[model samples]
Target chain A: MKKGMGTITAPWKQLLLNALESNSHLKHSSYFQLATVGCNGRPSNRTLVFRGFQESSDKFHINTDNRTLKIEELKHCPFAEICWYFTDSWEQFRISGRVDIIDGSNPDTFKLQQREKSWFASSVKSRLQYLGPNPGLPRISEHQSEEEVRLDPSIGPVAAFCLLVLDPDQVDYLNLKNNERVKFISTLDVNGVKNWTSERINP
Target chain B: MKKGMGTITAPWKQLLLNALESNSHLKHSSYFQLATVGCNGRPSNRTLVFRGFQESSDKFHINTDNRTLKIEELKHCPFAEICWYFTDSWEQFRISGRVDIIDGSNPDTFKLQQREKSWFASSVKSRLQYLGPNPGLPRISEHQSEEEVRLDPSIGPVAAFCLLVLDPDQVDYLNLKNNERVKFISTLDVNGVKNWTSERINP
Candidate 1:
């Protein structure tokens, strides 16, 4: 593990924090693959931008269109997994978690605040994504270009904007270059304090 | 889709084949994330090397340890998904598939032949992966380095070596640059000929 990472003492958590801090892969790219199980029990995966990470909460945040099929699938089954690969470090992190969708109506003040902050912080191009036709729907024209679809005057943000917060139950961090792997399992107590149990595992 | 430069005709398949041909991400790195459902119905994902692609059969092959939790997970549920992000192109492909494991003892001659060919094509470093300690097991010491663990003379190829073939039922291709997404669903006819149905979808 990277040394002197005093904020997180646990090896697995430290490793993850280290990757997020210094890894060029994570630094340059905000994208990671998200996996979720459909109602039919099939696993589906797609690339999603990693919006935020809270070390204390062991939570990951990603922005998605509320109308996407994955969102519908997540509604039926909250179980989800996300994988981030750091090419420069040859490290991969697999996080298994339960997803909670936070729309404008979410009761949690902190979460609602986060959603609002993130929504405003996002660029017009990014916000335009929520405005476009419902994701995964078939297009009407083969000749319809992306720019045309994106810039269509009729497009405007509706109520489908959503923030998905994943509270990881288990996180597996693998350093392929080192041939070392570590797993961190997190639990929250009655007081809402989070604790992590970590162990070094084979790669 | 790049047209008239013509090899693959199908737009979605052409995009994938083009990515494989020219994308620096796949060329410089062999790893892609694999997602599968655990017996309990949670999704799990990890990075694995992209060993081979059989275009004619529309299948992908990856070699892995048979004893891994993922292999066991695949046993319980054949449904799987893989995600590939091409950094240079800013494109991502999400492939949803059914997995089949093939070992040396498989009945099919063609599969056995492919295994042997792939085994011989692999490097000593790649071969050493199959010889390592069982994946996901706790390590004895924090000081234990990868080289020490690998150089252990006792380590050698075991029955754990296995090949995974993913027959994708659906492939979703997303080009971030263009903000365009396409879905290709494959079907098998009575004559055993595979066909693809492609449609442009919202990104």
Candidate 2:
């Protein structure tokens, strides 16, 4: 992975590295808009949290249960664009990439060994059809103990519908106040050699 | 316009009306991600500032120089989507609407009279050709004096692309918390009337 401000030498690799090293605050950012194409040819967007980034494999992952429309649509087409912005710093990054869904491997013993407990809990609760408009809908507190909820079989790899792995092809960075923006486009040939070209934008 | 959360009868209408009011903070919001369709059948997204909103007209406006790529693409196909989320509130709104470029009238003379001076200043600076390598750059130096930059008469009305209105056909509201996430999807017809039936989904 390479890193620089103006022209990205290795766009995808550099973005993966920068996203990983991004301030801890950014890592925890809750508002990321993902744009995907719908069957009607219109774009669909929804906000998702920045779950985490994996450095060694150079992939950014977000977990969603099998039920969400986005995950279901991705099963048919995997191209997507994700945008992340830090409101305080007026810094924004846009990643356009393809998504790969992981289902066979055990998330607990994943190559990165990064386990998201909250994601698991949410997935388990989601599968129960426990969510509805009424207050009487089953509550997490009523059914399972905290420990049981944490270690529930349904909350692990089996519970997850898909693990979205983003392989970025381009990253656009913009600093609002400075009025500076850069576009880094990545190119990888059949042999797997990767290259990136960066260009400064008039912001 | 409408008021009160429960005052609106239909669920879809209530959601869209609430979104319009809930996102009022967007009037003061500096950054917005506007997603449009590219000629290649891919979705394209970029950031813009929220200029103002006219409740009576049910229009949300964004200020941009006429020369921008967004403006160019918008002229060909006016459909677009805008997403906004506030930190203080976990509420996030996605509005998919249409863009209408108004050129004959002074954009500032519209609903944003309170911010005319600031808007005028920005309009002047934004007319300058961005020096960077990227296309359709954002405006730089919010503090730059409008007096220093000469406005080109040819670029007067046509130069400022005001109020990319989104007549929302569909809106999705996502409220996320530590334990539960509530998602609602509402769809409307071309006349902006709600379809009444909305799906509550597990996120």
Candidate 3:
């Protein structure tokens, strides 16, 4: 077992961080599933792609379109839990957190830099609501092609309604092997400091 | 848009069913993150695996250790939405549902079929307890080896406690593409019939 600075020092934590850092697949496509309670008190969940994480700031960022039901609900209630897990590895990170929509400056510059030209163009074009199959409908271009679209300027409106910043409240780490299953529970204080403890329970 | 069976078109409904059916990677995982509300009214999510799904019954099942916090709170509140999304396809499914503990003969059969051989061995060896590191302590074995442990009829006690079943109330399908986004919502009525509708949404 290795000791770490995050108030939780266990083998699993180190393993988790290593997995997150070393696995490009996890970084590339890990979707943060956000869960929120609807007006009727039922739970709701939506997938938000994992954008970036600032360890020093202890904040994670994700991009979302402004019109999602999740965004609408978050306006009414900002509390949510974000979850990510790797299918190949029996490891999962569940973050319970409060969400805030960040509409300042141009965060899309960062997102644009991370994406390929094709992906960025596709994303913008798709934003026009033209991908679905509708019989006898005229087609119109919604976005500029890769060569014509300018990143610096394109970042403005995209960033205007793009990023979601989550300040996690608690995190649960679970690892399951053939015989052993390990779990760690880490609760975050109001200041976003984590206090973690471990418990082994029946699998 | 094409119109057919019970509010949802045959093509779209087929797409929804195929998305869930063809995804073997999603099915084999041991745990899935379930988002719920904590006692403090904060969002909480934890990983639990896909147990089984009954097409005939239109129900999904997942199992968890009896001692987890979510299980305790779930007894008080059964409303939750389960989210599962595949990274490669960016395909997402959100199931709004009610949770109930499965017991009796059906649950017993489900447990035996769903649990891997290693899981049974771990339970037999001991109730795994999470203890902080003790210097020079002997390593405890959760299971001797996979082959050494056989399914004992005596293990029925532990088997009875961990089954959970979710009956979906509504399912939202989000298919994100480069040019447009397609959204489908399906609600299950009291008589266990499903009604679905689709609309194009701005991404």
Candidate 4:
């Protein structure tokens, strides 16, 4: 499997890798806006915590409840986008790609290993979300706290855990400090080797 | 023409109205991520400043340059969503709605009036964005700075200013402080009058 951002030669890719690796801004602001296509061809967006980023293959990693609307939306339309903003550095990254869902049922051990790693990485407090009632549905009760539900004997890992792999085919980087924005479009050539064409765009 | 965040009886509606109206957190961080559906059936998102919020009809207001890809995306798919997070209050709001784009060619005076008001509301620095070369396109020059581009005599508003009205049909509010989340779904019943249903979801 592809690993660190070291092998990426493209400037935009290098920049994104540096951001995610250095933990300057991307690390501090772990949450990003996730956008998905609805059945009616519209977009639905919500904020999700950034689980991981791998620069080698230009992939963003996030976790979600399998029962959420986003997962259902992805089943119909797997194309998705994620936008991240580093407020301290005044930089914004818009990553667009087709989603590859990796759940416990996937045949590949790599995906299963990743899912297990994510589960272990999550703290008790964080894991409580997945253990509680399904997202977007009515709450169990108005007064029940998340911790209470998590502590309930009936709840454990709560079967709805899934890992989403967003393989970015396009990355748009905007440096708002100087109004300099750039885009990197990835395509495979005749050799089937991935390549990216970068250009400076009007902000 | 929804005026203010007043007259909304639903608890989630009232919560959103209060947040936008109070401006404690929303005002401090005026920018939020705007998500749209691309023709390729994928999602695209970017950060844009919040122009206004009218609670009466659950509309979120924002402006964009007509030449941007977002306008093209919205034209093909009018359904969109916006995600706002008030860091200070630890509150996050995900709003989904249909878009109503208003431009110079639009006939409605109310929309036109709103557009004019937005124009008047913008500062010279803020208006420079519309004056620049089309967004997502190649930059005008490798050496030209945004201020230099703004000061150029040839550049002006370029008639690319547009107002986008997001008439929300669903709203999800999550309070990270206590892991309490709620959803407000707006529907039109047999009478064709808008009504909202509120529910507390497990976070």
Which structure among the candidates has the greatest TM-score?
A: 4
Q: Pull out the clashing pairs in model 2.
A: A202-B137, A203-B138
lDDT tens digits, residues B24-135, model 4?
A: 5433367789899877667889999887654355567788888888888898889888888765566788888889998889988777877877776677677776767677
TM-score of each: 0.86, 0.68, 0.65, 0.87
Computed on alpha carbons, the lDDT of every model, listed in order, comes to 0.74, 0.55, 0.54, 0.75
State the lDDT at B1 in candidate 2: 28
Off by over 4 Å in 1: A1-11, A24-28, A54-56, A141-157, A190-192, B1-11, B25-28, B141-157
Residue-by-residue lDDT tens digits, candidate 4, A1-203: 43543245555766875666555533347778889987776788888888765435557778888988888899899888889877666778998888888776789876777777777777766677676666777765666665565344333334688889887788899887677888888887685556888888888
Worst 10 residues of 4 chain B by lDDT: B149-158
Task: Indicate whether candidate 3 or candidate 4 has the larger lDDT.
Answer: 4
True contacts kept of 4: 0.93
lDDT of model 2, residue B60:
59
| lDDT for position A178 in model 2 | 70
> Candidate 3 residues B120-153, lDDT tens each?
4344534232112221123255554544545454
Question: Candidate 2, A27: how far from true, in Å?
Answer: 8.1
Q: Which pairs of residues clash in candidate 3, taking residues 3 or more apart in a chain or in different chains?
A: A126-B178, A126-B179, A200-B130, B31-B48, B31-B49, B32-B48
Q: What is every candidate's alpha-carbon RMSD to the true fold? A: 6.0, 7.4, 8.7, 3.9
TM-score of the candidate numbered 2? 0.68
User: What interface RMSD do all candidates show, one decimal each?
Assistant: 1.2, 5.7, 8.7, 1.5
Alpha-carbon runs more than 4 Å astray in model 2: A1-30, A105-155, B1-30, B75-77, B103-148, B151-160, B177-200
Arrange candidates, best TM-score first: 4, 1, 2, 3
Identify the superior model by TM-score, candidate 1 or candidate 3.
1
State how far residue A189 of model 1 sits from its true place (Å): 3.6
